[model samples]
Target: MKNLNLKSLYRQIEREYEELRRLNKRELEERKKIVYAQIPEIKEIDDLIKGIGLASAKEQIMNPSSDSLERANEGIVELRTKKEELLKNAGYERSFLDKLNSCEKCKDTGVQEDGRRCSCMENRLSRELYNVSNLSYTLQRENFNTFDLGIFSREIHKEEGISPRENMDMILKISREFIDTFKINNDMNLLFYGPTGQGKTFMINCIAKELLDKNVNVVYQTAFTLCEVMEDQKFRRNEINDIKYRQLFNADLLIVDDLGIEVTNSFTAAGIFNIINKRLLGGKKTVISTNLSPNELTKTYTDRVTSRVFQKFYPIKFFGEDLRLK
Candidate 1:
């Protein structure tokens, strides 16, 4: 969590809560307008209720008595009951005029009455953390619930001695286990090496969605994009690139997809090594999916990078025909 800029996050969430409150008020006003137009009696009841609350407050301050408060509460309840009956008779819900709240637990305020952040706020944080990519939209269609095993071929592969569907089923179980054990810092890193269009990226997306739903900070980037972030920070240092660069090391989980697709040179190789080695040393987990085999990966990058990857990462081989062609 180094240099996470929590103050900025708090400010953003506060603005979001303000917007939510404004939206709720606007929606309530629209509802009130429609209700008042249809049943003017309801508006009269509402005005009476308001009057009772104001009068009760003044009476309590002046007389300092409980009886006045009780009487005011009784009057308000009676008026509300009549309003509900009228709305019900007019084919409206009993609570149709009630103020709306997107999250009733926090009243859309992003914080509870007890001064703790709401679950909704955590969801927002997770979304904001990875808003650089189309993660929100991609995750919607690529999560575990949408995973289709039938699309994989059932025919046996000559080399692996198992059908693609069966292999994917096993991989799916492993992916689920990775998510289940994600909270524990067991130094579990996954390297999914396979040909393109074989569901490696899709599997990575599935794991990411599950973790993000649980409020884990997951950073997903293509290998090329990750290198660009490194290059940007190294050559053109700025606050934006600085934040993105730190996130590479600070995120709970880092997913480097399409590893071999990026341009490889001395700097890119060193960048890859630094990310992998740093995360490993810190006990942070990383998952890398690549089209290159272990040997090809070694030739494409430095020996140090390949050594760390092979030693620290649990290699998960994804093999099958191109699923897109199927």
Candidate 2:
């Protein structure tokens, strides 16, 4: 993905962290109040531990010495042990007063101690991106788990010289490979071209679902919607439109479905070429599914666009009875 407005995403995650920490601190304070009330001795131990920690910091700053630091550490440890014992005696868990974290690995911070983004942060960002792209409900129904190869005819597609079911099996294998090797810059792109009602869109959804689950940023939109974003970027600027426009080039995978269905003006053609060309130059993968054949696509789009489509993308042909009609 290009340098997507990830700063905005990080900022969002940061706000979530701030909220998490605030809630955690509030909960911890409540726990401390209960524990202190029930077991005054535990409160005394905690105060001593705090005092020792403060004194240790002062000593270390004023007269740094190994022996002094060791003594302060030992005192704090002993106080903590005594506090835990007191808590346990009072029928409270030893860790009842400890601040709880939503993610212990980062302690509610989106970034780890090493300054790398935490897994939780990545997961949160993935979900946020997925939500922004608005592809959950359709993906739920069209993903691989719901893909039924049994629906395709076993009889050979004479023009293609293979049974529809057999061709789909091959396509499925290729799609899985595409997903498996997505992280690698293998320069693999796919162009699904066939008549409407074939399994092209379904396969695209399957790939999108698999990649999205693995935290790969994917933007799936029809050619009409993609062109609409371009129009929005050029004419009516808004936050949502701007984000969607940026995502066209920034998402890890850009799937343009029903390509030839869009209004083919010079602006739309130029916009489509720009997206395809920019993504190609940036090493981002794209999947385009069209109801038009290669010849028809060439007639519809610019020669440069057709050239990139043919030269760069591996064409996957879908031919069968309309599975939807079944």
Candidate 3:
């Protein structure tokens, strides 16, 4: 999984907020309208706090007086109480008032976070990610029903050891179990290695879709595309540091579709190893779909990478003839 693009996370958040508002339409509209109407005043409220924040900083640095600190504390308490009351009158909860999913440390106006404008920091990072890609399509594509297992053939399953329906039954059950118990079981680092058009990607998507519905963060990228992006980032170093390095290595679950297709090189090898190794170390789950068999991958990459994957990843060798015949 590449680092979770925060833009994707923000888009998901906004989408969910909208969905809930839509769901609660009868009572939500007036409350929502009031919040929207007050949006313009957010700047004014934010401006009002700077003086107090500045004084508190100065006191802490120069005099370190309990008196000035107490006053600053009183100001915060009063402002927050007013904000809470405002929210209550509007029928919006304190949670909704913190839109931008505001920094939990400082509430909405950025008066806190070590006495600096922390909201601006979070907003800046979010804006950088938002500029990378609009990931709304990726989110929608995770819908489980989008998978048409009919694309994989019955004769193919027989060749592998089961009927098509039997194979599907297991896959479906496993998928559901994975979703139902994800927090406890986590992902198994699934390897859907078998024939082309054998529903490997579809199965991965089914799991991704189910997990996303559970509010799990997920990222999808092909090996080639991921390497290309990483290479560009590495070469440019510091050009784009909006997302942290650990984020790419530690998504709750990442789906790398078509894993063995990237052109093998030292850089690509290291990149792949870093992603797989990091996830495995943290016990995070990854789902990789590939046309390559374990043997093929071992030959292409190092025994180390392949062995680590095979040792940890649960194999779900997809079986079927190409369904194009039917």
Candidate 4:
């Protein structure tokens, strides 16, 4: 997994905290209104508590006598006790009128008073990773356990010597091992290339699901969509920071699907090369699934892009009948 961006995560947490506080305040005010409507005497109790508290503070500051201080403290405590009793008799707890935070430990602040991350913040970070992954809906159906190897033919091929089923079985094992040992082998990139419906996309989706379940950030984008976003970000008049551009390079795992089908131009060629080359240099993992052959890829993109791909990526050629047809 790539390193978690603590700064970004903390920013999100802060927003959540502010929202939570607003919600808690609203809930408390609404509940208090209802309670006051039911028992008008509750408002009197509140005023009494406040009056006694103010008088106690005035006495302590002006008089500074032990007897006066003790009597003031006693009077404040008596008023509070009377307030609680009135609330209880009206079938409401004293705390029911207070703003109730969603997280008691940190009061929905996402951090402790000692400046440590709260458990709720970790959960929020995991949820944020899922939201940005782009695979949340598809991962439900596309995972390693859901992959069907029976779609591949068991009959042997004369040239390859192995049946499609056997070849796919080997690929499946390799993919499983890759996910299992991802921590140590994170720099190992994968290139799944072959004809359409050969399970290239399925294999990459499986890898994504596995990593995402472990709270690893995975960015999935079709080649066409990715190019469009990059192009828009490049030409857009606004100077605001674009999240898509950042995730392209910063995500722990980037899966580019249908690589050869995008609209080809100078910008796309340079964008693809930059993404692949920079990710390689940063030791981030990437998976590319393409229907194009090696020659077709070289023709579609620049020689520099193809060279980096072939050199850095572990090429897995998928050769089987279309599983979608099956």
Candidate 5:
């Protein structure tokens, strides 16, 4: 998946804040007009408040006495008390004319007074990630809570000596533990490999959702799509594709699903190795799911690539009848 342009994303956030401010201002004006129409005394009270403010400014410039400032403040308060009473009698709240900010803390500015990013900004980033990952719809249907243990047969397998449900139970436990303890610098990678329909992709989705909910940066791509992006960057040399290429390596968690399904060639094989090797060296986590067996993986990729996979990734072999059929 293409990474979102950071500049564009922040620009969009600014535009949203501007739109929210505009909406709030418009709504407050319209509501105040209605209130003034219903209670003409509100207009008079507001005028008095403005007059008091102007008088205080002039007094401060002319006399600059603490007594004069205190009296001005008391006068403003008295007018405000009357205004509040009139608003209450007119069936409106005291702050009815105030700006209705979507986020009261930041006043819909997406930043706090202390210069920290607000939750609204984080939410906007998450929304952008959802769009970039193209997993918004899938995540709704596939998460840890929604995973059905019943779908996996409980009967013991003749060869593996474990039921599908029992094996999945263990996998589920490990997945949960991984999410709870995930660290950017931890050398924890996962390789979920098995035949199709064994719920590998579903499990991957569950992990993705868990990490994403924590506001962790995650870039998910099918092996094919990843290779396509790499190929575009290698040949086309486009600036945008280059940014996406860097993002694949820099994401907190990179999930490359269906690893052996991409159109493998010298370029793709090299690209895959570079991604895995670089991310591992950088201590970034990755989760790769594939239909290839251990031997097939060794034969298909370079020895260095296979060696890193064996050393770095916690291998989880999925073996069960294709759940999609059920």
Candidate 6:
């Protein structure tokens, strides 16, 4: 399969990695300064630890005797005791040395043991390559943290037979469970269908955020953007497997938001079907949000596409007014 233009992505990811490293380094330095500023005497005590390490090394080499070893050991004792004093006086822990690992080993220099990649480098690179945003416009008033069930009316109970409040609460609960218990291959493809502002997209966004946080390679795209990528793959062929199609096909969680809202064409249908079919065959988890009802899905994409989705996906239908207006 084809992949992303790695040459372009590599440089971009590198730049992002560097920027993240700078941010981390600044934060670390600020924290260290805050810590050390309180204990100006740590300068003297730390100075002594370094002296002890060097002096012990030199003496052990030159003398290699019990007396020299004992004296060096005594110096080690004094150094540790001084560190303890510094900790107590500074109101800090004795393992203030543990605080030095902002980079965990390389001190944010980005080099690990024996010149291998450091933890900081790994984290930064991961952030760059992995931190993709589906809705970068900064979605407002919607987040997993603030999703409230009380908004759905209890009247929905008698009217819809399954109260909107109860149904939405169940959906929210199960979605959270699904995210927490997410497993590759075993995860079910989900179809969220309903009117606008019915919490379909918002709920999936919550799922996407949680799944991505688990380091799952996810693509959360508005259907328009999703169709564009599909068109790009089929027409211009500017992308590679690793970048677009493959990631979407194989992502632990793939969310196509506002499906059926895109401009419809043979290309769109084929592209969407291909994605759904491929993932279904592979047992990957996919999510599609749409305004179309079950019958409408059949009319739009034919029984072949609709059946594949119905049989393979856990169909979740959302109802009610655009909750956002409420």
Which candidate's lDDT is highest? 1
Cα deviation of 289 in candidate 1 (Å)? 0.4
* lDDT-superior candidate, 1 or 2: 1
For the record, the alpha-carbon RMSD of candidate 5 to the native fold, in angstroms, is: 7.8
Clashes of each: 0, 0, 1, 0, 0, 6
Cα lDDT of model 5 by residue, 228-304, tens digit: 77888888775556656777787778899999935458878778778888888888889999999777887777557
Superposed Cα RMSD, model 6:
7.5
Candidate 2: tens digits of C-alpha lDDT, residues 184-292: 9998999999989998988999998899888777877888878877998889776555666777887788999988846578888888878888898899999999898
> What are the lDDT figures for the candidates, one per model?
0.85, 0.83, 0.64, 0.76, 0.82, 0.69
TM-scores of the models, in the order given = 0.64, 0.67, 0.60, 0.61, 0.65, 0.61
> Which candidate has the highest TM-score of all?
2
Q: Residue 272 in candidate 5 has what lDDT?
A: 79
Candidate 4 worst ten-residue window by lDDT? 237-246
* Model 2: how far residue 158 lies from native, Å: 1.7
Which portions of model 3 miss their true places by more than 4 Å? 1-142, 149-158, 185-187, 241-246, 324-326
| Regions of model 5 farther than 4 Å from truth | 1-10, 16-130, 261-263
**Candidate 4 local distance difference test against the native:** 0.76
State the TM-score for model 4.
0.61
TM-score leaderboard ranking: 2, 5, 1, 4, 6, 3
Query: Which parts of model 2 have CA positions greater than 4 angstroms off?
Result: 1-15, 19-134
Full-model lDDT, candidate 1:
0.85
Give the lDDT ranking, best first.
1, 2, 5, 4, 6, 3
Q: How many backbone clashes does candidate 2 have?
A: 0
